[model samples]
Target: MTLVSGPTGGGSIDDFELFYARRALGRLRSRLGRQGLLDLLAEDIGKGEAFLRESAGLSGGSFNVGATVLATRGSTAGEFVAWMDKAFADENVLLAAQPEHYVMAGQPDGAVHIVENIGPHVCSFYLGSWSAEALAWAADAEELLPEAEFPHKKASNLFLADGTVVGRVLIQFGDTDDGFTSSLTVYLPTACPESVLEHHLRHFAVEFRNWIVASTTARA
Candidate 1:
């Protein structure tokens, strides 16, 4: 990731992601406790998400891992539908639209399981605090924006149960304060195109699972 200045004086997503990843990895390795690792990863993911969101000119919403987890504590699969229904029952617009500025202002895009370990056990992931306005507007206008123009589409700030993974590339469309932003997050599992659920499971699940296992083993 080369650190190049965009038309603006700010650094590009590539620069930020690289810097963020290095810092995050360092912090992850430095921590000797599971809680410390989770905190560091959450903070790093928030910073990375903010960088990409701001660099791409989207309104960078607040980044929160705990908030996301708490929001979905009892949520079931596809529960976003129910959540959105209750959230927007009075509003005419969808939650995806005006995401940052809407009622569910601080809520993330959605929650997905990073991995299902040992059958019922699962590691959940949350990525919010980035804007999706550009994708939402683009869809309505039938216009397409380049990946560089929209960071959310090019990259995602991943938060696992235990470590963090950045850049999960996916062509996602949704509405936000800016309109409809179309872009991908940076750290995805692989180059293969998969659903959000599958992407998390493949890329972040194992890493987090291993971390948890190691932490438990060390404590024991």
Candidate 2:
């Protein structure tokens, strides 16, 4: 997989890995056979759902991973936030957010169903609920009280069918003179491998960039 330099100075995944991950299913479709592939995916999705349901009753820690990006020119925090509100509320927009093996469905009840095909035999799926919050400003850490902050923030607390908190995805944005700066943080189970965490961070980078672009092109 090709590596792209991250905003925080670490090596991050490039479009190669993202593209490959989304196409894994297509690559194996012929070999698995249509029925065989469906059966396999159904079994996996069922098992994954069951695992989430059972694990919902248990409490465990998670590894916090995040990625930040700067969107310069032709965008503002307010506009992005408005776009997000509609995107999360509309199932079509949600489905169009990432476009392929990354499936997102926004429900009438305001929750989202997210599924990602990470590899030929592996998929990560979950149901989550979103909320808005106010977080302290990261740029003004030294000040006694940093008035400069990300005023627009939304976070999704990932859960199981039974409402057990499995993880969280926090998205925050602040307006800049040129455009806006946004960041996304994900909390996943500690048992998850480093590669999974890295992939998620890179996923954020790609997905959010797409959303930002969409926001700009949206009919006003």
Candidate 3:
């Protein structure tokens, strides 16, 4: 696959990968057959959904899995990111924060779960520290995701009002016809499990909601 590199702000990770994957898949499908492509894609989608569900310990079995695949099939990276952003925002359980990149922090443990939009059908999780131990753990984990090695940058340690280390989100922005376009790159520790990570995300969401309620009450 050709790695298109320029300013990081030009597109999302999902958009890059999805565009290439879909194109390749399309060519293969045409040569093979539509049913052949659908069958292969269906299996890939199922595996992806299962991995997410098992790793994240999500209760609502594949709520938006189908939708996610459909949107990603032939869409642009920018378009997929928009849909993903909206989909994530609409989830009631996870408190969505686009601090810069889409970061969902766990309230109870203060662990930050990092998610990145890669093209239409691909998204990535930032494992903490990128240490040998962390990579090993991820390898042994239930979800089998493609891994990339990026150079590490010193991240500012951030704390919530409650004294949790949620880290900082870094977003790259570019000029687009839609106004300003931005994509988030998240920093997180590699030690967290999908279950624990998700739990913290839910806790943070609830806490944020409560804070909003309390502030509104005080104003009232």
Candidate 4:
């Protein structure tokens, strides 16, 4: 599958589904911390990539893989939810025309939302360290599960969200890498029209980028 980055300057993951499959690692971090993020990555980044690919309904081949976890320097745990809440959906954040398609879910305790965007869902999460016990449950196939028809090496894949694009993203992969592969996808329930999906996606991407740039500057 071709890989792409959301817009570098501005835009949502409008037609993002075309070239990018996305996931949020920060949810795990909310419960597990920075180490939690690392543990999951170490155990099964490949699995996650495969899951995204299948779910996004993209053609399969090779994909570029990269991730960005932004944090607000010096914010207490209590401040996290509010900060991310706005990031997910606020005047400056959420940018969808049909409001129903891009719903924002606030964080609950340390657990973040997984998403239910059948019609409209925008999952909110925070990024940090990794969790050690993040063993490869997501990556592991059950003993009773069916096996693949033909086995092939795992390959690198890029993760993206609404508004992000695959234009330059695929051009960045190096070589000789593999991790996981699975086809966990979503069916439309609250599925919005393509144009609405694009708008919400772009909103999600633009909001995320603004937060990242601001947070980075604060840290610097």
Which candidate number maximizes TM-score? 2
Candidate 4, position 64, lDDT: 27
Candidate 2 residue lDDT tens string, 163-197:
66666666667788888878676765565555656
Candidate 4, residues 108-154: lDDT per residue as tens digits?
Answer: 33222222122133322221111222212214422212324212211
* Residue 112 alpha-carbon offset, candidate 2, angstroms: 1.2
Quick one: how many clashes does candidate 3 have?
Answer: 15
Residue-pair clashes per prediction, in order, are 29, 0, 15, 38
Q: TM-scores of all models?
A: 0.22, 0.65, 0.21, 0.24
75 in model 3: Cα distance from truth in Å? 22
lDDT of every predicted structure (CA atoms)? 0.33, 0.58, 0.34, 0.30
Full candidate order by lDDT, most accurate first: 2, 3, 1, 4
lDDT over C-alpha atoms for residue 176 of model 4: 20
At residue 144, candidate 4 shows an lDDT of 16
lDDT of 3 by residue, 1-220 (tens): 5447775666677777766764664455346443443454555544533444343333321111100011112223333334333433332223222211233333233234433222222122332332234334223323222222112211223333333333333322233333322233332333324343444344334433333333334335
TM-score of 2: 0.65
Candidate 2, position 140, lDDT: 29
Which candidate number maximizes lDDT?
2
Which of candidates 2 and 4 is the stronger one according to lDDT? 2
Lowest lDDT 10-residue stretch of candidate 2: 137-146
- Give candidate 4 misplaced runs (Cα > 4 Å): 1-108, 112-190
